[model samples]
Target: MGEFFETYRPQLIYALIVVLSVLLLRFLTNLLYKWLLKQELKKYPNEKPKAVNWVKRILNALWLVLGVIALSSLIVNEDKYDILKHNFKLILYLGILSIVTIVGAASANLWFRVSINRKIQNAEDPTSFKFLRYIAVFGIYITGILFALLAFPSLEGIAKTALGGAGVIALIAGVASQEALSNLVGGVFIISFKPFIIGDIIKVTDTMVGTVVDITLRHTVIRNFENKMIVIPNAIINKEKLVNYNLGELKICERIEIGVAYDSNIDLAKKIMQEEAQKHPLILDNRSPTDILNGNPVVRVSVTSLNDSSVTIRAWAWARNYSEAFDMRCELLEAIKKRFDNEGIEIPFPYRTVVLKKEKETHKNHDAGQTAE
Candidate 1:
């Protein structure tokens, strides 16, 4: 055992040195990464510093390369060491390329998010900016991959072969990624057409009512009234019929429908509804200059239908946005109901009349028996 230890002392020493060097580099890299991340968080409290993660990843790769190089230099023969050294340089080049690409992507993404947040705060449209950000990030990743393939000597032949078979590869990829490509195209169409921007309240289906929160290349995110996020693929959402509450006009005309007893005064009911809607804070005066001049009412209340048990009165209440409109309508409903109760106007339930045919037949048979007796 003593002879073995003596003979292999140089190899053991080399291994220990390589391990320590890698550990030291990793420790330093982690410390630097954590410090940078802390500073970044201080600068942007809401944002996660993704670039630090990229830095850490690249530095780890660098330590790995250094360890391999140290090991080769100390333990391997001269010929093998030279070959390993050449490979080390390639690895170093690739590592640097990766770091640049990943860091640039992360930095650009962060910048875009920050810019979009500012736009949102300023009440500006961020739909185009968000779309462009996704496109730019995707393009950067693709370009990096292509450059890496072209720059590496060993991958050059493979890249050339792939290019030569571009047509076949495209055909195969098109078939395999048809849905993904459709979603991408759908996302482009949505951004270009501007059906619904972020912050717009849209009803995609009867049950899928929400505000558009985010639109990405693959999907759109909606935050519903319940505060739950619903992720729908771009293609599916684009194909579905949706009602955009903020498309052309931000103001919404909410129909506040109420039913009162048939005996209730129709004019009084209409006046109560109009007055209740007009007094709400969120209610908007959507009357135009001509309308005001023509003496049009701010809140228009009309008798829509006279049902069997009650009269259905509807008031058109305008609000600046969907959220305000919803809140306004709810408050108006409660207020109007209380006002109607105080004014001696009753909201009637659906009255139903039922006749029993068996009871009528029994009475007729008893009358026939009495007449016979």
Candidate 2:
């Protein structure tokens, strides 16, 4: 046993040192990770500490890799140790690059969340901010990859070769991804010129009416009335004519048209419509100061058209938003109909007169016989 210990003493000592070093490294990394998580929580109480979690995972992975390397070094011969020592700088560079990439990406995402919160507080548009977050994250990853390639002497040569043919490679890639590129460009345009932001109610096609839920790099997501998500390609959406209800002014004017019997008192019907609209809770008083001073009616009712059986009257009712306007219109319709019935103002239906052909022929024959007599 003494002889065995003497022969393997160097290996045992090296192994113990490696183990102690790994334990120390783990303890220090845990301390750092905990501090970072606590700070993140303090700064953003509502948000999850995703960046700190990512850093923790990265540190764990790094420690595992370093532990493996250190243990393996104990068994390797002198020549192999020299090789490991020679390439240690390359390994360190790659590890540092990985850490920087993850940290940078996490920082970009954090910045994006902060900007979005500020925009919401200020009531500013956040469409551009949302789209730019993806761009920023992607750029960080690409930059990290480039740095990694430059770190290795062999990969540095390859990078130069690739850069030399970048033009041709880019042309081929562009041709292959034409539609994707178009969507990207469309996304950029949409961000630059604010057409509709998230939460805005918009009509893309005659059949598609929904609220903008999310705008991504390639597509826009809309949640329709049925609560189904509709994904439209940015390229197509940019080309189509859009109707945005929540654009400049969120107020909407709802036109309620009701037909009344021609014999019914038109003035009474118009007054009832105006009264019902004014009584609705969602109705907005959008009249200017000048109009208010002039005593303009809260709801404007007008004779739109005179039909064969009825007179069509239209009431312009204003509401603060599309949802309120829709609700107000429906309630007004029901209320006005009841009021019309109570006030003896009739809503007319179509009337058509019909005669029997046989009766007409019989009458004509009787008239002819009487003429002959």
Per TM-score, the best of the predicted structures is 1
What is the RMSD of candidate 1? 4.7
Residue pairs in candidate 2 whose N, alpha carbon or C atoms collide under 3 angstroms: none
- Candidate 2, superposed: residue stretches over 4 Å from native: 74-91, 149-176, 205-214, 221-232, 259-268, 278-312, 343-373
With candidate 1 superimposed using the best TM-score fit, by how many Å does residue 206's alpha carbon deviate from the native? 3.8
Q: 281-307, model 1: which lDDT tens digit per residue?
A: 898999999999999999999999988
Relative to the true structure, candidate 2 has a C-alpha RMSD (angstroms) of: 6.3
Overall local distance difference test of candidate 1? 0.87
Clash pairs detected, candidate 1:
none
lDDT of 2 by residue, 209-281 (tens): 9999888889999999899999999999999999999898999999999999989999999999999999899
lDDT of each: 0.87, 0.86
Pick out the ten consecutive residues of candidate 2 with the lowest summed lDDT.
167-176
